[model samples]
Target: MSLIHCPECGNEVSTEAVACPNCGRPLAAPAPTIQRRVIVAEPRDDGFPKWVIAPIAILGIVVIFLLIAITRNNEDEANRTVNVNLATQRRTAEPRDAARDTSPPNRIDVPSSSTTVNPPAPPPSAPAPSYPSSTTTVPPSSAQTVPVDRASVVIDAKIATGAGAIQSVKNEKFYLLDKDLDAILADADLEPIEGNSLADSFGLAVLYPDRYGDFRRDALAAISKHIKYNATTGGDGRAAIKNVEPDSYYLFGITKAKNAFAVWSAPVSITAGENKLNLQPARLNEIAN
Candidate 1:
């Protein structure tokens, strides 16, 4: 038999005994002991807890929302400021535009109630004095008398060759001089007939047989006054010097073909009126070689 110690009282007891004999204490069968396995959990290095992460994420989201709201507020404020400035500018410009539209260009503005009174103009000056009407008789201007009978001379020239053949002298230059041809030829200081300025003082007229037979009265007047006179003769080899003053004149001619020249003199008397002289034809001879 196995003995066992009781827990409640210090007494030995049989293994099958239900009670202690000395203590007379009823002993309950020991309750079946329950054995449980103990498991040891290891510490882990995981980050924040799920609950902490959620809070932090929510807080970040709130902060981002706040930043976005602040940015929107700033943009709205800028927009409002710009709108206000534009409105102010528009309001300021409107009056100026209205004034420009209403005002007339290049005009002076006078006040409405003002009266413009111009002073009365002074009385017109006394009437001009009336003087006696005088009749003025203007005397007629004197008429200048032109001479009806002016002096004129006609000349004809011919060429006489040694062969005794006679031909009308053509393209010969002729001249009328106030002095004798001998006097002119004797003067050593006298220039040649061609382009001679002194010739105008001595010579009355020059005649070119090839060109103009008719001479103007003005030209004749010029010659009479010792002024320069140029003339040309017609193809008929006839020339007429008209409207010459009363004087002595010498007729002379020069021929280019034979280098021949000749002179003839006649005392011409021109009265106050008309006179005509028919000169005899002269023959021109070639010069000796």
Candidate 2:
């Protein structure tokens, strides 16, 4: 309801109001108005939902591992291929070496017999031509001729002491034989020198004289002083040795001449008759003059 105030002693008087209640102040002012404000509250969902990326991160790591595994497998396969090729090469090399080892040509075998055919003989060839057989004569083996060259040589050898003589010669002999294996002649001799001289038993020496009466100034060079005989006696009498090698010759020792020890004979043919060799001064010691 609307109300009024009394001045001085005014007091609120309702539409039919009366005296003031206390202090003579009347409640006559309209009731003061208050503004009311409306406030609305926003509803918030609980704390932030947790991030869900951990599973996706783990998935990425797995994919990376798979890629590495695939790459490693590829590398292993390549290595295996290379190893197989190397093994094949080694296997083939062995047989290649064996084939090379077996390649040399081998000896071949041949059959010994062959077949042949014969036909009936034709009419006898017109009178076989006659030839003279009497004119041709085959020479007897003993009469066969052989050619040889001869050289004559004279040698002088001496031994100063008996001891030296013993050392100088063992046994000596002369030999003569033809190509026909027949003996021509043979002999040997030894003798003593009457007087001796020594500038001290200096060993014996051999000397030679030229056909011109001059002595060989180099005596050793001109003579072979080491002449000796062999003891074997089984050789043929005619040949001195059978089946003499082609063109071989013989030499004989010399005798006489001061300090002479040997004489060399001329090389004779292995032919008939002319094979005689004379051992000078006789086969036994001759009287020294």
Candidate 3:
């Protein structure tokens, strides 16, 4: 057993006592021993951990690829179906179009050869009828005297004023009538007649005697009728009555100078050919109102 002494009380006590029995003093606690343990941590990286992130990213990529493949396959299937339908439609329409293009434009019908036909014959021509013969005969005559074929009479006239100088008259028309000379002359009223009145009353051949009977009556009436002739002065102061039958004739005419009218009368004879007469001028007298 070991013994120890208390300083305050000077008591003996066991070595392991916390307080002494003789003196009430507190004991000091012993210092504990500190043992140091060295712990080492592994070096951590600054970014995300590769173990968890690598698996998630790989799974995402695989899902995206699967979706794209599915979409492409669907598009190719739709295109193939459309192409097949178009080809089928074109094949179905070709035969009908070729038939329409190759059709004929016209169709002709042929007759059968079982029936026979005959042609008609031509008509006959008739003969022409014969014509009768014609003959001409001549009669014998006793005397061989040649008859006069044609005759013409030219009657010229001028104004016989007391003066020696002759005057020219223009635009005078004369008449030739198959009338009774004695009857016309017996009526004193017919001596101073106008040209228009003579043509109207006696149906006389009126002519403008400007060019010396170049425009006179060519034909005369038969000799059985009494003949009367007229003379008129032309632009050259000469009047002519042409193409008269060969006979004795009485002539009558009237000329106008200013307000006075001159009445004239004479006798003329025509032969086989041309016969010219220079008649006497009549007196100028006033016309009765």
Question: Between the candidate structures 2 and 3, which one is better when assessed by lDDT?
Answer: 3
Kindly report the root-mean-square deviation of model 1 from the true structure over all alpha carbons: 42.6
Model 2 ranges off by over 4 Å: 1-50, 93-289
Q: What are the lDDT scores of the predictions, listed in order?
A: 0.44, 0.31, 0.44
TM-score of each: 0.31, 0.22, 0.31
Model 1 steric clash pairs: 149-273, 149-274, 212-232
Report the C-alpha displacement of residue 96, candidate 2, in angstroms: 4.3
- The local lDDT score (0 to 100) that residue 58 gets in candidate 2 is 90
> What is residue 209's positional error in candidate 2, in angstroms?
74
Residue-pair clashes per candidate: 3, 17, 0
How many clashing residue pairs are found in candidate 3?
Answer: 0
lDDT of 2 by residue, 1-289 (tens): 7666666565565644554553455344446699999898888776754465787779999999999999999999999999999999889867755553444322112111111111112324422222211222212133222222221211111222323331221123333322111011201111111121110001111221222112222222222232222111111211122223333334333222233233324343332212322222211111121
TM-score computed on alpha carbons, candidate 2:
0.22
Compared with the true structure, what per-residue lDDT tens digits does model 3 show for residues 1-289? 6777787888887767888878777555446899999999999887877688889999999999999999999999999999999999788767744553454311111111111111112225322222221222122121222223334444445554445445543445444444433355334344212332322222211222221122112212221244444444445544454445666555544455532344334444455444555544444442222
